[model samples]
Target: MANERWNLNTTSDLTAEPGTPVGLVNQPRTAAQRLTDRPSDYGEQIVPPKPLWYLDKAGEPHSLGVNEPHQFLLFWRSNVGDKAADLDDSYYMGVTGLQGVGVAGHRVTINATGEVLQPGGESSATISGFWDKSDPDDPMWTPIEPETEYTVTVAAHNQSGEFGPDSDELTITTPAVGYDTQQLTLPPRPPNDVDFAAPLPVITTSGGGGIQLRWTTVPNVTKYEIFDNPTPGTTDGMDSSRPGLNSRDVKLGEVNQPSAGTPTVTFTTPAYTTPRRRFALKVRAVRTNSYGTAYSEFSTPLRGALPASTVAPGTPGAPTLTVSPVVGGQVKLTISPPTINASNGAPEYYAVYDGTRQVAVVSSPLGAAPHVTLQYAAAQGYSFTVAAGNSVGVSNPSSALTGTVPTPAAPGAPTAVAVTNVTTTGLAVNWTAPASANPPVTSYKVYDGSTVKATVAAPATTTNLTGYSPQTAYSIQVAAVNGTGEGSKSSPAVTGTTPAT
Candidate 1:
């Protein structure tokens, strides 16, 4: 309703001309007398001249026919933008028209907000010449009648509700009804009568091999257009007024919202070459309507690196495995970075795997021997491998490394020893095996008075000692042996005696 309302002369400037009776009603005053009124008499101030439109290189107005869709450019200025650093302010273009005969109260007035005008240049906006019959109650946009004469005037209204003087009148006469040739397409009005500024896009890696761009979805935006600095090495100079704003940009692509209720749109680069390249990117939102496509301002530029290679790096060499001596000790795997070439590219990090599953990833930069330690059960065997990886992808795994943790201790002592026969020169002995053995017991040893007398294979608990003198007494002991070496001698040595000859 505020758009439709306007102020007009209401109070007469009539005054007594000496002989005229004072306080007379309906008395008319001269135009000169109204001009002499004090400033206080007028409640509003006049702005710039009325907005003017289309003139050719010859400075002559172009003619339009009612049968064809007609459009024209409207130019106007405000107090703003008088200086170079000033920003353009929003304003309404007030249009009023008369058809055939000039009639009171029958004229139609329409106020529409136009596109933003840049400062320090010719400020202009495209305006439609005719209105559609979409609204039965609103006749301001109704098409002109055939062969009828129409009179139109445009004025600029500031946001503060002050109207400037009207422009020179624009008059048109419709041709015969059959003269139509072209259709008129008007641009869609901005949402809520205000233009939108596009939100900036966030650039990052797509995780696998390429660059990714993400941004917030704007309401009324049907699609988004992506732009990149044409040159890979140049930074974006985002001065909107300069020709570089659009001239230097290359349109990468455009995308629509994938689905409803989605708040973000993502774009990943296609497979890229090895030795990744960098990019400077920006985005803009667009909406299409009956009038035409409307675009939000371009977002700020973002710089990011793209994937280096499309192919995965080459397989790495086998890693070396080290087993600690103590049971349950850590097993360390030292990985050497894979060799890099044109075919393999360079690896960013190394991945350590146990059999087919990945156990850990070494995030260290390439060219270093990454040491990874894992706790292993005592004497348990393991098989592991390593691989190279980068943003592009992962390489084939390296040769497998197999090993086992060192046993924490030797086997437990042998038990249950008994001497069977005693003679002048020899004796027979047997014993029960130890209960626990790391790496499994492999042999047994016999000790006579602190000297190793004999060695026997595992699972055997019997032995014969034959070097004793005829009437001598001897102390005998047995111990278990395994991969970790022999255990302590059996406790409480058995006493044996030889008979005299």
Candidate 2:
């Protein structure tokens, strides 16, 4: 019970019999008033450790060890409580008064007893905690200065998030410059290292219909900052007044580097759009410690290379297609640009597909809708779909439009016509059916010297011409007919003559 101290149970308990020793228990306090008579005290007071020289430079005397602004003498408690095993595992050391250090306070993990190297090859017993400033919301231990007297303090933290009272204050004095043996001075350097170059970020498609950015990992980098230039090639500098680097550059987001994994950041929301979409992307490495944060210069866009979009445009909407019958057994496919949402930007082109097979890729022409004319067999069924595509990738195909070219317009003219049987009054005209008839040759018309002599139904290539003048020669021609109407007459009319009756 050596670590346990007497604490006020409550303000009302002060009224108890002076020597009663009643209502007093050594149980650890869980409330704000449990540590001492002060209502503000919550946890038990922790024992303070002796301050030791914080020597970062070799051959430096202990009296002049605080050479760097970020260096501080080591202060730690061997064990948080009497039980070294239990307290060290269950409690943490909360250090305050590390002026010029990170965010004014820090919660450092307890380190096993170690040694700090001293001058003349001598070593001092030291069990210190590592400084942590990665989380902006958490306590930050900033830089410490040399030749200054610092009032440092420490408190114990329980597993339940309760803090013990501050330990006895310790005033540690840093040696003044030009001490006995010329005190060591820290090398001149900027608080943060900004000379390193950042890796260029690459934008790629995400499996979840979003976009992902990746970059090479940098050593000692805790996180990566991503910036996008909406207008590529602009020389605008980052403006602090705005959200991103400048009026043109916007910070996409920051990704914490995992201990072991590819450096990547994925944005699932705020999908990309055109005209306002990110044209190029850059990345910078960030490192933080007790000294502060150091950032590498943002990677510049590669020369003569298109910058990756902050977010690849989302898959575009399916394109609408219209099919019309063109002359000569061809079908004209007119495509209406898909209704691209703001997130999809503008499509660069369209892909036309027949069933699952791709048939054509139609680039968007200036001031005109995309169209393609394809030869189609008359009356043959057709199924067509179109998909919109952009710089990133293609979209899902639109709904299928099913249709076929109109049946062949009127069959071709009869191939051959001749007067086979010549009679005094009438003669029989025979001809071959027209080839390339879509609906098949349905009927034919016989012409005698530019006059319609007779009409015959299809399957009967021959027709009899009656009422012709006897002993007169006649010019005979034949024409094919279909659902659309009659076709051209056979070329070069055949002549026939009848013997005198």
Write down the TM-score of every candidate: 0.27, 0.24
Among the numbered candidates, top lDDT falls to 1
Q: Tens digits of per-residue lDDT for model 1 on 121-187?
A: 2334444444533454663444434566555555444332334445555565544433222122222
Q: Each candidate: what lDDT?
A: 0.57, 0.52
Return the clash pairs for model 1, or none: 131-141, 186-291, 187-291, 187-292, 276-308, 327-408
- Candidate 2 clash figure, as a count: 11
Q: Output candidate 1 Cα RMSD.
A: 25.4
Model 2, span 251-295: residue lDDT tens: 777777667665433322233432223346666767676546666
